[model samples]
Target chain A: MKLIPYLVYLLLIAMHEVIWRDVTAIHGVTINLAAFLVLAVALYKSELTVVWFGFFAGLILAAGMPDRLGWHALALSAVAFTAFHVRERINLKSPFAKFLLMLGGLFLHNVLVVLINQSGGFLYLVWHSALTGAVYTSILTLLFFAFKDGYVTVRKIRDIF
Target chain B: MTWISRLFSRHSRNLHLVAILLLSAVLIYGNNDLNRYVNRTTLFFSWPFSQVRCSIEELSGVNAENQRLQQSLVEASLRLTELDEIRRENRRLRSILEFEPEPGYSLLPARVVKVVGDKIPVSAVVINRGQEDSVLVNQTVINQEGLVGRISEVWPGGAEVQLLTHMANRVAVRVAESQEMGVVKYIASRGMILENFPIQGNIRQGDLILSSGLGGVYPARLVVGTVASVEKPEEEAFCKVLLTPAVSFSSLQEVFILRPD
Candidate 1:
């Protein structure tokens, strides 16, 4: 509903890009920015804002990464929609809930991406990727929590007025 | 208001599902198109941020490199003196052997100023040398260690040296031991592959591969690289030989553009 959260979203995206610029593993793991954006939108739960942010976030992710178009858009929109539903019913104001939801979304998004890309039954590769994705996403989710509270408090205050 | 609500709202859950499905459709469509314009536009927007990050990284890299370079320069200066003495002795021995030195083999020392452009398989290194400095197209370029590549395009103040590892380059090379001639073609997915050579001729690992004088582009006996592997698969048309290039492209700082005789 407010401009502050949108600005916060942009800042978060930039921070993610800068932080996860380098690939650490041989197979490599992406930071899943699109998934993060989806979670952020769900955390806020304004449908129009979520859709617009998700679309733009999809565009950003698609542009920076050489992956085929629409993949990120599909994934982000799916996650965002799911998150938005959860946000509507549950008290998702807690950082722990946000982290768990994001962790699950990241797991689903990466597995789906890997499955779509892999034509052959490369089980070992897929397994390794999933494991790496889990570990990396957990760490990123923890870092996301470390920064979440301050932004949430500020937004809550703005919303109360 | 009721009509608008009915048309637009439905059940929120169903609406959400439809939105996701629509997004998925859009995403699949976008990927299928694979439009270069979208990708480039994205890159353009993000370039400034990427540049800032690159500059910061480069600044730190340059500082560490400056210290190491200073130390290396001292060691290299001493090595140069020793090398001069060895070269003089070698020249004397060559004179005794009646080995006439090839004319027009003047080495012009140049420094790499920038990497102007890069594609998947092609990259051009812009050197400080130009036509003003007698740098011409097809001039054999080499570092102190071994062959780098030839000057591809010569500008008035700068020239582009197409590294030997570039996909477009192919050098006619001869095996130093067996004297077997082969064309060294740069394959994109793979490194330099020696193609269209004599099948009977055997090439072992560590065999010295050099530029053959047949091409008239690069001078003969310039060290290209050592053969890393020799794969002779039966029923295949040509031997699948891989060569590790002598010069490292990413680390190139200084090079000499040798005038082809």
Candidate 2:
């Protein structure tokens, strides 16, 4: 609910956008860090918070990219909304479920981006780029979740002291 | 019953989602007006990252530079032999006809700042130079090896170059040895393909390919690539030619913008 966390998320997204191209690109496929972040927030945060996070994160990414401005915002918001609804209906406590959610979110994001851009060879693009990117982002999401959990545990121990 | 309380009611979340989506749709519709400003702002924010990218490139470029230098040395030796043959031919041709060679063009040096759209096969790269340096859209970009790409968009302090490897790019090129002309295009995973050349034409492996200046987009005779392989399919009217680009896109760092006087 605090504005500070939202601003911090935006800042992290901005920094990720700047460096991810160089650090994460492999064989022309890159991890969609923004999408992963959106999914992570959706899984952990309140519905309203996740929705706003998705929109703002998408906005930050769209601003930096050359694609049509709203594509990312729309995609992220939709994915976040879906993830939030899914979270309400099901238990997403399992790592496998979280990974699947991450992949689905990234895939939906990529599909929206391609469609909005009206890029030619839609099927080929989805198969080659979207799927690969989803897998890469999902792998990254797993690592991020592990790190976050470890950090949370460490904080809890420190609080007890 | 206050307006503020109503705005924060249960439906407020849906309202926020709809509002954000609507705003995004509006922005998308009116993107042209905001694109330049957004790109400039992004460029400003990405400056530090660009510096870091340059530093990393510098650190890693040493081995690549050494390999390139060694390769160039071998090429120089071969060129020396070719130059002697060309000199004799030039003398013979000059005696037969009065002609003048084309004047050399000056190059505006620029450093690459970022590569965009890495997830897709087609992507553009951002360069440090911009309109301030007289860099214009569609201007030819090259490095020491050969043609890199053409300027696609130019902002005040930066420009985006659509690399020849981009699927949308179609280059008018000619075989240097035989003067056979064709259009070179990128075919996703297949690299550069020179199409529309007659199967019977003198296209062959190792023949130099250069920009023919037919489309008026690029200058005449800029080195594009070499005929990597020539395939004459029995079913097709034209030859299937692959090119090994003169410039290695992966190792691209410094490039020159050819601004014809």
Candidate 3:
């Protein structure tokens, strides 16, 4: 319930959007850091916190494009609400289950973004851009899950070295 | 903290959802200035890191360009050396503009393809012209400056000249001022000395020595060298005269064979 941590998370989202987005992109496919963070908050935080954070994160993502501000905020909030409910209904005791939740949430957010921007036909973008981006984000989600589940550790890596 | 817990309670969830929806609707239909202000605030917070990323990329590009410039510098240096050689050849050719052979003989231009001796101011040379070009043995060879030597042995496509630096090579000469005749010969240690001139011959340094036409091989009045020093040694019969050869044999490039008309 501390307000300062959420503020710090929002700052991280803004930093990723402004500085790391282009640098981390792979052959024109970019990581959806904003959606991933929103889904993460939905997984662990209260419903109200996730929803507001999702809205603010979308605003940060669309900072350069003012015309799509409202649509992006609405789309991201909808994804966060759905992810929060899915987490509640589904048994997420397993890291794989939480990873599935993150992947599904990110894919949903990407599709809505493509739809809101009218980037192209839904089926065409679904495989090429949206699904590829979701997969890219999901890899990061799996790494985060591994760290949280203690499957990987810095000490273990050093021991190998 | 109590109010925060109450806000996350099940009942307040619906109110928070409605509040998020209303905020979205207001922003979507609201004036453009509101959205722009929010965007501006976000970008202002991220501006410093964006500048740092740009600087890093520019530094990498400069590193690649530095490698390219090093390659270009090496290429330019080789080109400059080639151009300097050509410039020296150009100056040599310009001085050859006034060159003419003797009245009754025609000059055949030939390049010195190789020198045949180990000594500096080489003792012999091979010219590009040979028997195929009407070149034969014992033909006098001269450059625009003065005498070089004579063709010694001829091949089909080339001929070698016995240069005046050869110890056996001799020229019958006379001082231009006194017309006092002498014989010029090469000595490895003493170098191009006038061996057979009279002790009292009117010869001195700066006097021009020319071929006297006494030896049937070389023509009359063809300059061989200049008297560089004159010493009437008490023990010697002839004046001990040292001459600086007109043609620098070491740097010989082009010459003319005096083929009889």
The TM-score leader among the candidates is 3
Q: After superposition, how far is residue B139 of candidate 2 from its true place, in Å?
A: 75
| lDDT per residue as tens, model 1, B95-193 | 434522248576677888987566544456999989999788988888755788889999899999998877778889998888898989777788778
Candidate 3, residues A38-85: lDDT per residue as tens digits? 998898888888899888888877777777888898899999989999
Q: Each prediction's DockQ?
A: 0.19, 0.23, 0.57
Provide chain B's TM-score, model 2: 0.60
Best by lDDT: 3
Model 1 misplacement above 4 A: A23-30, A64-67, A88-98, A116-122, A143-161, B1-27, B30-34, B56-72, B80-261
lDDT tens digits by residue: candidate 2, A1-161: 67887777676677667766658788878778778778888887998788878877777776556455567777788889998888777667676777777788889888887777666799988887888888887877887776665644666768999
Worst 10 residues of 2 chain B by lDDT: B93-102
Q: Could you give candidate 1's per-residue lDDT for residues A67-159 as a string of tens digits?
A: 554666666666666667767766677777777777776777667667656755657655676556755776777776766667546567679
Among all windows of ten consecutive residues in candidate 1 chain B, which has the lowest summed lDDT? B92-101
Models ranked on lDDT = 3, 2, 1
lDDT for each residue of candidate 2 in B88-205, tens digit (9 for 90 to 100): 7676445424422237777787888998876544457899999899899999988767788899999999999999988888889999998979999888788889989998899889
Give the alpha carbon lDDT tens digit for every residue of B97-186 in model 3.
678888999999999898796787589989999989999899999998898889899999999999999887989988999998999988
Q: Which residue segments of model 3 deviate by more than 4 Å?
A: A3-11, A116-124, B1-11, B57-84, B114-119, B166-168, B186-191
TM-score ranking, best first = 3, 2, 1
Q: What is the C-alpha lDDT of each candidate?
A: 0.72, 0.80, 0.87
- Report how far off residue B188 is in candidate 1 (Å): 77
